[model samples]
Target: MYLVLIAWIYVAFMMAIAEATSPVGSLLGAAFTFLLYGLLPMSVVGYIMGTPARRRAIKAKEAAEREQALAANGIQNAGGDDASVAPNAHGEASGHTIAPERKQP
Candidate 1:
């Protein structure tokens, strides 16, 4: 039982680092996994139930910022029509086309 507990703690620490480095929902996974593996049975239940909500709250905040940027740029919806002009194939704008290189005799 003691060895099992120690193993769980080690796994939790690794999961925490993995979660911290990932862009989405990683921290939640790490938190829940750690709680389930390390906490007492009662605490495990509460952590499992609560962690997703916390993660969603964070996601919601990020979504709001994205929405604000889109609105400022006059975009109707998320990822629908991108109003921002893209650069040309050679990575220059229409007005700033690069002149072709001429061979020097």
Candidate 2:
């Protein structure tokens, strides 16, 4: 029980740090870390699992942003409508629907 409590506290701290460093919804890494650590009794296993999980979460977030950008730029389909695509305050595509330019302007 004590170990579990300690693990929970550790997870909370890690998650708080993650949340503070990244943008919105970036604390998923900490949540995943906490979950995995809480589920497993071995600290070694928790560390191994948590590391990759955090990395995967970050990669997934980046990929999502990239996709949104592509959609916004019109390089990719925005699910068939402008409304479906995320738009900026000015109603321009949020760049998720459009592809990024490879060349410098």
Candidate 3:
């Protein structure tokens, strides 16, 4: 990824040099080449190519934060396997439902 950027910079430098030595108008050509070839294309391509990496990083961070929060709440981060987790709620594990303790007439 970074190699591409470096190669692009080298290309831009060479283009600018070529433009600066051109016969028509060196200054305008160099500026145009630097902006059009160097800054614009590289930035757009870099962003497009780096989107997946950025998204993965964001997902990893979010997952870590969610796991941290779940751990803080006494819940295990068992990779979303709910069956492996047991809550402290009454009768939750024994399949017994919680209801009122009223006497049956």
Q: Is candidate 2 or 3 superior in TM-score?
A: 3
The lDDT for every candidate, in the order shown, is 0.66, 0.65, 0.82
Candidate 3 residue 4 Cα shift, in angstroms, is 2.0
Q: What tens-digit string does per-residue lDDT give for candidate 2 at 1-105?
A: 346557776776776577657776456665665556554445565576578779999998987887788767676654754353433547676548867889978
The runs of at least 3 residues in candidate 3 whose Cα sits more than 4 Å from the true structure, single-residue gaps closed, are 78-105
Candidate with more favorable, higher TM-score: 1 or 3: 3
RMSD of model 1 against the true structure: 16.2
Return the lDDT, model 3, position 60. 92
Top candidate (TM-score):
3
**What is the TM-score of each predicted model, taking all chains together?**
0.32, 0.30, 0.70
lDDT per residue for candidate 3 within 9-63, as digits (tens), equals 7899798988898786588889889889998999999999999999999999987
Model 3 alpha-carbon miss at residue 50, Å: 0.7
In order of listing, the candidates' clash counts read 0, 17, 0
> Could you give the C-alpha RMSD of every candidate to the true structure, in order shown?
16.2, 19.1, 7.0
**Sort by lDDT, top down from the best:** 3, 1, 2
